[model samples]
Target: MNKRLLSLLICLCLFISVFAGCSDEDTKKETEETTNEITSETSGKTEPVVERGTLKSFGIVPDDYVSFSAKMFDILGLDTKEDIYVYNVPQEAKVIYIEAYSFDGSGWKNVWDSGAGITAPSHMSGEIAIEIKKDYSLKISGDYFSSTTKPLTLSENIENVTVLKLDDFWEFELDKEVPVYMILADEEKNEFSYNLEDYPSTENLDGVDIAQVLTIEFSSEPL
Candidate 1:
C-alpha cells in the first residue's frame, strides 16, 4: 500500500546522511587548514628571548680592559693582575683544567686546586682553589687537576676561599706569576701594584688606569 512512499522516504534519509557526512568532512578540512596556518606563522615569525649559551651579566672591571686569570682558592682578592681571578666551578665538570696567561708578550702558567687528591706529609701547601664557574646543578670530582683547561683563578691564601656549595668543594688554585697591571681602565687613575718580569718605574701613571693582567683559561672534557 505504501511501497513508493516508503522508497521515497528511504532516499530522503540517505540524502540527509550523505549531506551530514559531507558537512563533517568540510568542517574537518577547515580545522586542519587553520591548524597548519597557525603552525606556519609561529614557525616563521617567533624568535627566542635570549641567546643560546649566554650565562649571565658580568660587571665592569675598574678599567676598560678585560682580563681572565687563575687564583689561589683560599684568597679572594680584588687586585686585578695582582690578585688571582677565580670562578666558582660547578660539580658537573669531571675533568676540568685551569690555566693562566699574560699580556704584552708575557707568558703562561697553571694554577692549583685542593682536590688534586694529594695527601702531602703535613708540610705541603694545603690551599684548595677552583677555576670553573659553578651553578646549582653541578658537582666536583677528586681528579680536578687532570683537566686541559688553561684559564683558572689561582690563590693559596686560606682566608678568601669562594664557597661553592653545589658540590661541597672548596677548590683553591694559585697564580704562577702575580699580576702587575689593571686590564680595565676607566679615567679614574686607579693605582694597583703587580709583579712584572723586570723592574720598571714604580710610579703610577697619571691619566691611564694601569693594571697588570693575569690570563686564566678554563677547559673541560666533552660532555
Candidate 2:
C-alpha cells in the first residue's frame, strides 16, 4: 500500500510540472505579442505627414509707378523671366527669400527684404518676398514702366470694381476710367482672385496707377 501511494504521488507531480511549463510558455508568447503591437502603433503615430501637389497664387502691385522686375532663382542660381515666369527648384532648397531692389538711376538698390521685414522705401521697385514649401505663383502688374513722375494705366473701364485692403504701405489713386490690378488675399476662398469686387474694404490703398497683369510661377518639385 505504501509503494502504491508513493507511485501515485510521483505521477501527479509529473503532470503538474508539465502543465506549469505550458502555462509559462503561453504567458511569455502573449507578452511578446502585446509588446510588438505597441511598438507598431507608436511608430505609426510618430511619422510625419507631408503635403504635396498644392498650388498657391498671389497678385502684387508696386507702391509707386516705378518699373518692377522680378526673377526667380533656385539654389543653383538658375533664373527665368516672362509674363508668368515658371521655375522648378531643386530639393536642396529649403527656404526661399523674396527681395526687391530700386534703381537709383545708376544701380539696383535693395529696397525691401522679406526676411528682415524692412519697410519698403518711398520708391519701391515692386519686389516682394514669400516663404513656402510647395508650388507658388506671383502675378505682377505695372512693372514695365519705371518713371516715378508718371503713373501707368493698368486697365480702363473695369466694371464691378471691389477694393481689397493691404497691410503694406502702398498708395493708389481711384479713377473711374482706370482700374488698378491688386494682389488681394481671399482667405475664405483659399485662392487668389483678379476681381476687385470680391473685396470691398479699401482702407489701406487710396489710389493706384499700375500696368497690365503679369504672373510668375515657382515650383519646389521637378517639372
How high is the CA lDDT of each candidate model?
Answer: 0.31, 0.32
Cα lDDT tens digits for candidate 2, 162-209:
322232222222111112223322213333333433222333322322
Q: What TM-score does candidate 2 reach?
A: 0.22
What candidate 1 gets wrong by more than 4 Å, as runs, is: 43-223
Report the number of the highest-lDDT candidate.
2
Q: Model 1's lDDT to the true fold?
A: 0.31
lDDT of 1 by residue, 62-142 (tens): 111112222232245443221222233333322223223223223222232212322323212111222333221112222
Q: Please give each candidate's TM-score.
A: 0.22, 0.22
Clashes of 1: 55
lDDT score for residue 76 of model 1: 55
* Steric overlap count per candidate: 55, 12
- The residue ranges of model 2 lying beyond 4 angstroms of the native Cα positions read 45-223
